[model samples]
Target: MTRDLLSPAHTGCLQDFSSRYTRTCRLDAEQVQSLLYVLGTTLKANLNRSAPPKTKYFSVKCTDNVQYIISPLPQASSYLSPVRLKDNSVLLITMKEASTQENDNKLSVWYYAANKKVLDKAILHLTAVDISLDVDADRDGFVEKNNPNKNAWKWGPRGHGAVVLVNCDSETLYRRKPDYKRERILKSSDVKDMSPMVLRTKGPPKLPEGYKLVLHISQSDGENIRVFITSGERYPLVLNSEVLSKEIPYLGTDEIMFYVEGVSFPDKDFDGLVHINLSLLEPIGEGIPETPIFTDTVVFRVAPWIMTPNTLEPVEVFVCSTKDNYKFLSSMQSLVDRCGYKLNICYEYMNRGDRWMQDELEFGYIDSPHHSFPVVLDSPRNGKLDDFPYDVLLGPDFGYVTRVPSRKDVSSLDSFGNLEVSPPVTVNGKHYPLGRIIIGVAFPTASKGRNMTKMVQNFLWAQTVQEPIALYSDWLEVGHVDEFMSFVPAKDRKGFRLLLASPDAGYKLFKNLQNDGHGDAMLFEEIPDQDSISVNEILDDKQLQAENNYVQSCIDWNRDVLKRELGLDDEDIIDLPILFKLLEYRGQYRAAAYYPDMVNLIVLGRNLGIPKPFGPQVNGVCALEQEMVSLMGNLGLTCTFIDDFASYHKLLGEVHCGSNVRRAPFDFKWWNIEM
Candidate 1:
């Protein structure tokens, strides 16, 4: 700061040259080594506060090691040019010669007073530091130096931003909690999940007495993320709130490495983008608090969890072996073996008689440039299988996530069977390379029907990769979308087909059987407890026909929704011959499978595990099986009828409802999609 001296006799204002105070400036080593360095800047502040200073002539005087630097001149002028300091001007200086080691430097200047006869000089102190903050914002796998846009995010192939993976995967099975839930990294693999940040500093072995560098995160970001600095044995967590920040002394010749791990996922509450900052604080006065002279920043966005569809490659199939489902388990084992995929069976000990494995969890995986792994999305429906995912499936590279709403909101619609995904689709020119998620909810106009819990829906919607579309499933007694609709692989036309259970198809198949003189072929003729009904008897039941008409209307409403939302054509659908019967639930009528729901089947590669539909036997084989084979035969699919008649269908579910599958993730990278 400079002050003026004015007297009536002199009638002139005091200029900065009249002051004896010295100006000291510090430049980083990188800046000093450049062709030109900005030593200081001058600008007009407020005209109302103070008048602008007049341009003053100046002469530079400095040590031999450093000199006033300027842009290269034209060939016409090689002589030293006169220097002047004015409003909105930059004083450029640089090292006289390049040097690898630290250099003690100084620069001085003399300026003429208003009298034009007197001269005064001021000393300018100079120093250089090797402080460079770096991050992989460009995603080129190498840390870039001091980029101005490091703290911002950009999308697409040419964008720039660091990536952070949700530390959702586990590295150890000995621990009961997930790896993300642990306070510290459990193994070397856990460290691989974080983004690398480097603070490269080189100077004297120690910083000047009162200078230090501190790393920190904002308070809001601190809650959803954690940062660690690599030391000897332990990577000390810096953003642990107890300290909230960590100070790095002069690294001398070493670099400080920091790893950022996302503790929370992208949801309604968190936006998925996080920031980490580094500041250089300087000591001004002995007792004065240090001031932050320089700051650097880097940003990251948590990767969204992605769901795999049935059309993708199958990794494995999971089913619970209950007390009454032995026949179903055997059928599933044969189907899995024939398909050449692994089978994971949860026996009675852990399942505790809860047979609906599809209701318990959905399989998804989070991904980033650093790492990716399968993360099981546990549903709010807390059946006896609640502990199965957390206890068994969570180990090594596997991850776990769950949303538990209030018990009052929990319903059958909250089950994972209510959750499904279409194959990759392009709706309205917008492509979904990973496919879109499907969920069951009450009809939009209905006020008293059941819907999937809001908390679970929020969690699913936050996974922006595969945006979800809701279908009406409250018409069914169990309120699951899978009870009426599914997806399977196909050779052509979008690579998959939307399968829907059609009561019209069921009646048409039966009428053909009756016309073929198979009317006496009884439905449930020899089945254990079902009363036999002739095809003619079924055709004469006007009330049954009326209920089926109502059920067909419900199915058609969803059929239109699926066609519109998934960009499906009429040719893309396969209507299976399955019928539903309405029953009184509470005060409203909801439909349940009249026989085994053939559409609620598991699709593994080209193999299908359909629930055995106990229909009228016109020949040695069941007519329903023959009809299903005919429908799927054109697609080069094989049908394996799983006899879940008493174990699953009688209990108001079918094959897909009781079994779950974990398929391989898409080969496409999720981050490349334009959001």
Candidate 2:
């Protein structure tokens, strides 16, 4: 007969119903119960072995009537019955005494002992130590020693060996005396007893209203600690506690007000007298507030008194800001110029919004009001708002707003306008209000010499300003200055320089300077402001395009005269076109580096193709073009001169009269012109 352990659902069944003697098994109440008990125990054992391991702790109950079943049970089951066997270590935290005036005035110490007997012996030695005999012991310094046991004092050696002590002065000591004096301090007592305290006062303990006092106890050392607090005071009462000292509230004045006190238990060294002065509390709070309670958190750490002595010279300039913008506005040069007084700025990065600034204006009453940017003045007396002038040199009528997309072909005239060629003192496309006309100049290429200068003058004259003339140049493209470079020169010229290798309009200007022995005037470099990054490349491209266009315009103008007015013919026009092409494309790429002598060849080889207007004329045209290009290059000027505007205008008129109407401003039909 084999026993099967795995099968729970299968059981022995009656086979061949008519086998009377073979079915000798008992089916009575006691037999059934006994068999079930055995089966249940065996099944439970097997199931327990097969079940996977559980990681958490659990409570289990076993009963004789209850069969082994994996199912939920009620809470009142026998499993929940209490059965204690082993004892565990316990910690006792006790408050020994409240902090009264006597305790508050003294330095306190708490001692730990294993048992009452050890504590008694320690107390006896401590009481007899004669702490005064120690070197440098202050007779006046207050000192108090406390132990856990109340009965241990009786066993302590009296007179000389008493362990517990108390005092009400400064620098009191607790010393351990020599063995010879131990007997003298110790009392010969057969049983335990108690003693008393020295210098008893006549008054009862006094505490402020709403303060529930308690003595804190250290678990490991059994040291007792205590501190008192009023209703609103949240002081640190625990030793070695983490303490955070908060700022006191300001009472609405330049003299800031804040209270000092500890507010935690873990830090023990938080006791110090804070003088509570304005300068010391400068960095304490956030900016001003709308309501008294809406001020910023006034928490800060103050160094020792020596670090901020009372005799320290008061700063002339009172620095303050409601917004966080002034955080990085502390450069020494800016400080001297912007703030009239010495550096006395409160460095608190409080984000209180508009109300902060409003409060500053009310409380600080600074002469100049600073919102997003500082309102700096040339002098302290000039801080009056009226002293500074509005940036309206261009005047009202002359102003125009146009969103000129940054283009390679056009230089942005100003933040709000675009430029077209014009002359000086043209008032709004009408009259010439020739007062002192101030013209502003800005460009990526500073070496443009008199060309840009004259161009700016031309733009101003086209605007027609009726004021005295004041010409300004932005030498530096500072971020803000880049937008208003044409209007104000004082703030923008710091970084201005004539970049020789700028590869823009400056290229032509640089060449001119090199030819004229004034190249040194244009060569300069400086770090550009970060905010001007967008305009940097855009302006550079514009400058390059303008330079190229100027060159082409000059060549086209000269060619027109040489062909039509001077009657030079088609060969002459072709040759001039070649010259312009050579001048523009000669040093374009790696080819120039290889063929360095090509410039000289082109200069000497240039000659007209033929005198005929439409005949075969490649050689003469190519030769003439080379000569003209080389000659132009040697001059170091990109043919920007507008010598005959009137003649050009007349020729355009004749062309327009005979030409067909076209959609584009410049587009026209040659047939129409001929007709």
Candidate 3:
């Protein structure tokens, strides 16, 4: 043995024993026996029989007349295959080299004092455990540093690193792995099968229409669970989990409570398909000690509040009442509240014979913008009152307003009378510039013992004009303004459009003529001649029974059929039938009205028949109940009957808001439809 084996400078690769080489390398059974025999003989001939030498052990054997020791030559396993091996040549040679005791360390060294033949046999048993030709430490450090994509030696229970040791393979090095993706989190969440995840004794009874689920996480304390939703967005939510958590702990408390809101999306993807997915983020188990696990997998979409054309806006609408018809007013108020908008209502005085009262009443009572609700309110200008009662007929005005005066009145002077007097206008107790006062008259109060049918005719007259303005004699006594009124411009009064019905055939006509192609005919009130018509005439025996059946069917659709099938409550299913019947009724009116005037409009406008300008309104109306059910089947939908413009706006707002999520003020555009 020599000191070279222990020298750090003479390093060689013997780290991994299994991967590089195995137990059997160079000799057969007979060859090994013969080599061992010859090497034993040589050791006896060279060294003293009684004296033994001290050196690093390689492989040694002593027999009857011979002593043998096998030494790894400097070449060792590094020797490349020679052109050929001579017979009994020393591939596994046994050699007896002298030993130096200066450095006897852990490194394996060769033994001296052995015959070549005997040493060869001992070396044959020295199987190549780990034989590498590197001969240097740095050359075989880590394989991971060179190849990133390859799997490194990992220490986990399921990987190869578990079975391998550090010294086994010197070339392999370990690296980090990626995070696991299992589930997702939603912005606007949906609990499709909520029963399993949370304690849903009744499963929240399916979310109602125009309502959405907003997530509110609470810590064990009364405070909300604060988290940064956006990396840089400044706005943070201050949720009161007390309302959402109820019996549960605060967000990230002992357990975080998730408050979910119901919502839906239409055409959310490039394929024009509607879909829902969860909102997700890599949650850090920082504040909470334990690993946070979602008890329920929610279906949520990002709901961004924005100020766009589609985004909701609040408006205060003024409505008048006569003869204690507060039902209409109350209904309208509820509608506005439900639609998620603000409404302002105020009653005013109208002529006994004037058609303004009823028109105002209907305007005040709009189920939806599609269905006319005439309401009158004083317009506000620059934080000041413009007039006491300037009529504003608003709804889904497809385009512009067209006003036509029907007749004249002797007592009329408001247009000039009100303007002539300089009244101090005060809004919030502040005086402002005075403008021309216009006397807005809502004719024919359904109350006040006036004919309801005649009231509708007045509204009809106002809607049927093509020009921006019109003047006419009160041949029908529709309004006294017809007499003195002239040069009144059309103001796009969609609010004034009312669904009128006569006692005789009004209901049938109104129901049938909903989306008729004839603008003029459609403009005619269902109860065109109220004096001669009766409710009995319109819904006579058989017709009344049919209406009853239709109503019953609608009720069933909402209660029995819809609720049971969709797993909705009674109230949620109730509104669908009412709207459906209303649709049926309106459809009939439209069909009946179209035949007479359809030809004329089709001939005149040529390409532009009875303009389908009512697309949004009509779409909104059609989407009323059934559309909601179809849209949000998993979440239930039902309607609350809207009575006036205020409620109608609210409903419209809620509907629009509930349909899709709006991003930031500038993030989204009409062209961009993200769910």
Candidate 4:
């Protein structure tokens, strides 16, 4: 029977049995022979007792329903018998009686060790099913379980049978077979963990008041990390931490933290967000990758304290009151009243021949008053003068009375007979050492070569103070820094903006007027009939070429120096179109004068006081005044035009020199500021 079952002629039968069982079963020839012998003996015994004398062989019919239901049970089942083969090996076979409902109709063909100790050490391989096994080692009531999610098989208290079962859902069994194979492959492969995690941060949404802002960073084990805050390109605030000495903080581990310090609200109202950036750098010797290792930005909203300008003490306007300037006093007084500012009229009188009350000579210049004064919260000089000294005066005859409070003290003179001492000027309740600041001087040819020794000494003195004085061309009769450049509060309220006189724009206006045939009128209208000359007579082509070259050189030099000193860009400057005229001074030497001196306008807080240009109208318009007013309006400034043609402009002076401002003290401590 074993030979017949193993023959090629019975291959179809074997396949049919396997199909019905729905599982593959491997059997040795000995096990097949035993099964056949048991069936044969039982059939012969039953047939002999029931059949008549003619019944030599018994016939059996296999029904499809019975065949399908009578499938093999697991080898560990109690009904399975162990056959000891002639080779001394045991073959476990499930009997037909083992196919019962209690078995869950599951065919468990895999074998297991009967001994509890042997079964405990045995390995059971499975794909997706979570498996478990239990053994009663001492025949005790307690059964030890393993792999709890898998089916459990209970051995009798005597530890008679050892069972193994694999349980899993149909979907998991089908899906996880490939995954299990891949996991085996992965475990065998030698691969390094090269991918590092990104840096992350957890912190408060808003910064706390009067306390350091703390932030926690997720652990970055091996990479170098850096963090900082930025407001575009301007470096204003400081970022400090134990790990950093500069703006960028470097960290070896994420456990360390950093903070921002010296952060203050802007002078004006500002509500916005600032970005904090975290950067991670790859380990050294790791070549540059296609992209940066890691970069992340976190935004935080800021609400800073609000402050208003001090109103108890307002800015003051100072003007020289030489005898000739007395006529314009009423207009100045009216302007002060309208703008709600205090007016200080310096009445010190001085005579320097015919040009004594010239605006450039008398007014004097103050560049940055904030840096010059000492701040005090409460005092008579809360924002005003501290002390006035006489020996420190700049000059004697050069002093217009409004400039000098003491006349009896004569200061030592330089080679050109110019006073050499630096004076103390009072503004906003504080006194500044004028000697320490570099003063801009414009010495005419008469004063230049006449006293080279004294001039060099003055220059050395200026250098010794670490403030190299700026010396512009003195071609103009009233050449002065105030005549061409003035400082106005910036729109952002951070600092002041420099207002420059744009000669290029002025030349364009002149060209336009000339093309329209109004050039002669602009040149001759201001002069008397006897003295009037045509534009051509005043400046031939050769003279005009020289003048253009001179003006361009002056403009370029001034612009470059101002930008270097003030750290200004083009955006920080406002250019006002202003034309210059060549004129004979005392019929001996030639001099230049700005036709309108637009930059010479006065600033009173947010308001401006400008001079109304008085000259020939071009194309039915006073182009200078029209342009100045239009530009001021566009700048968001309220302007008041005061007529200074007869009083100031005719004397080679303009509005700024005729008046000054003791601007309001800023709320911030200037001394604490880093330059």
Model 1: pairs clashing at backbone N, Cα or C within 3 Å: none
Selected candidate, larger TM-score, 3 vs 4: 4
Q: Candidate 4 lDDT (Cα, whole model)?
A: 0.35
Query: Model 3, 247-288: lDDT tens per residue?
Result: 221111011222221111111121111111111122234564
Task: Report how far off residue 97 is in candidate 1 (Å).
Answer: 10
**What TM-score number comes out for model 1?**
0.88
Native-to-model Cα distance after best TM-score fit, residue 433 in candidate 4, in Å: 18
Residue range 464-561, candidate 2, lDDT tens digits: 22222322223212111111111100112221111111122223533443465533331101112212211123224554445445434433443443
In model 1, where is the ten-residue run with the lowest total lDDT?
A: 41-50
Arranged by lDDT, best first: 1, 4, 3, 2
Count backbone clashes in candidate 3: 78
Worst 10 residues of 2 by lDDT: 122-131
Model 2 error, position 333 (Å)? 26
Query: Can you give the lDDT of residue 664 in candidate 2?
Result: 12
Question: What would the per-residue lDDT of candidate 4 be over residues 176-260, giving only the tens digit for each residue?
Answer: 3211111111211111100011222222221112212122232220011223333233222222222332323322122222222
lDDT, residue 623, candidate 2: 25
Instruction: Report the C-alpha lDDT of model 1 over 1-675, residue by residue, as the tens digit.
Output: 332222112222223122221222432212221111111211111111121134254445566545443222212232233333344333334443322343356554444444433244444454555566678887766678765567898876667788777776678878667766777776766778777888876555665567778887778788777888788767867775455677875666678888888877788888788888787777887989987656667888888888989888889899999888888899899889888999999989999999999999999887766567898999888999999999999877788888879999999999989999888999989988889999999988998889998998887788788899999999999998899998888999899989999999999998999899998877776578878788888888888889999999999999999999999999999998887889996789999988899899999989999988878987777899998998898888999998898898889989998888898888787767776
Candidate 3 ranges with C-alpha deviation above 4 Å:
1-528, 531-539, 547-551, 558-561, 565-675
Note the Cα lDDT for every prediction shown.
0.76, 0.19, 0.21, 0.35
Query: Which segments of candidate 4 are over 4 A away from where they belong?
Result: 1-314, 320-327, 346-438, 441-475, 492-495, 515-545, 581-591, 618-620
Better of 1 and 2 by TM-score: 1
